[model samples]
Target: MSFFKSLFSKKQPTARPKLNHPSELQLNDIFTFGDSFALPEAMRKQQLQVVDINTLEFQHQHYAQIVGQGSGQQLVYVSFPNNPKKLIKLSLLLSRNEVEALFDLDAFSEIFEEPGNARLRPLTKQHIYADMIADEYIQEEFMISGYSHQQDYRGTQPPQYTEDQHGREFEYHCLEGGAGERSVDIFIFENGDTDVYLSFLRPANEITELWMKGE
Candidate 1:
């Protein structure tokens, strides 16, 4: 009886290490990076189509989009022009409510780590959310991958600011990594709404070369 009980006993779940920064989460483990886009056999049966960005007139120039037939499923492909292998695929299955809530200050800022350490001060509503649309996307799409709860911190001190013809701009770099790197740039504008640019930069050397050469 004792032997049988020991054999059938349940094991406790192992705790994940406490993460201090977004840079500690690895993007590559959850999503395929630096690879050609291929629909899963199941998804292929649903009629996949590569939509031209020009037809959609997407404001963001860095990513290319692909859509599924009638399914609300979509993939955003990030790659250098003429180079297909070095790519990051962002899978999106967003609801209307989630999309609208992204622009809300409280909803958008919820994903960032709350400040507590002596070295870190609590972030203001504007500073906490600031141009962080990527947080919403990740929360909605990648939550199952365990990145939704990861801590994110400013990669640069004081952030960065600039002025352009349109308006004043504030830029902040938030990053997470362990197995791979995921870097995001949040661009806050005085006259316009915020914008987010996310990059999965694992296997860094190759990506750096491709980016530097404007490939």
Candidate 2:
């Protein structure tokens, strides 16, 4: 939490200047797209506050925290209630090879054929990382939507997908919300591996209020 606090605390002036070209605006530059803005400090803070392992709740039930570690990598996910129309997806990727191996598994095939079975696998590292990475379609959607590019493709970057130790990196994205809209907030953590969390339906503002009320 402290790490995130520091990461979001570094702020530039809020003033927006006219850009000569969209390319001049770096992905990290806080910019507006439709109803969404790049994850700003306030939004990031709200997300961190509500999504903490200590605060998460869904459907009047507390979430279970599950952790997985192996092959010099680690992954963590907190289980929450599911929405019928939209679901929050979490994935942990240890290596590029592991991701490739996913395509050949029977269980992976079943996930596509029966989507309702997607859930946090048991804490065993092999079981968790292999079964939980974002489904291929979601990965493709993220990439095509430009969110992946904004994060420098950190979620799919091969260097961070290796077994070698490296400093951790974090990336965030916020999609718009409201009536007939399915908003998603994505968080990616990269170390020797990558852990991705996608939040749908429950936007940061609602989550923050829910946490505050102990709901």
Candidate 3:
């Protein structure tokens, strides 16, 4: 990874800014990884102390050692039960704080993510980082379902559908989840993404008519 040595320099480890999401945080804004601002709303209510800091000579990188105890909503996939915190490399900026870190979304995921739990579904990388998608429909659906009843059929996993008649097969690659109010069905086709319920939740023949008309 390229270093931004000119942007930030190391500062006192005791100094840090509280942040929720760093979307609006300017490039110059600085904070330590252990600060409560770097934590999720629920995780912040509990103790997330910075116990140690270590560095690697090979990569010329420093990482923070954190320990979090107590309990609250499990927003992250990883659990912190007397959880020996994950060590993540701090980015190098030209500021006066070499120890200071930016706990942005990617950094935040690394801390909460467990080893070897990645790559469950290669097609769903965004879901892995809890990242956002631009399609508003799928976004809203994910908000409702929260990965529950999730279905994946991309990469090596082919669509499970047995129906002989079908349009563009990419529509078959989907993530269907939940039911009732907490429900979402998204199809990531070659051309674009669309809600399954919107595009294909009708009689096969009726779907054919609409699909042909759209084509």
Distance from true location, Cα of 55 in model 2, Å: 19
**lDDT accuracy of residue 23 in candidate 3:** 19
Q: Candidate 3: how many backbone clashes?
A: 14
Cα TM-score per model:
0.26, 0.22, 0.17
Per-residue lDDT over 129-197 for candidate 1, one digit per residue giving the tens place of the 0 to 100 score: 232222323321211110110111223222122342111333332333212233333433344445454
Cα distance off (Å), candidate 1, residue 167: 13
Best by TM-score: 1
Candidate 2 residue spans exceeding 4 A from truth: 1-73, 77-86, 104-143, 148-215
Alpha-carbon lDDT, every model: 0.30, 0.29, 0.23
**Tens digits of per-residue lDDT for model 3 on 33-125?**
232333333333333222222211111221121222224322211111111232121111112121122113342233223331211112222
Question: Cα RMSD to native, each candidate?
Answer: 21.8, 17.5, 24.7
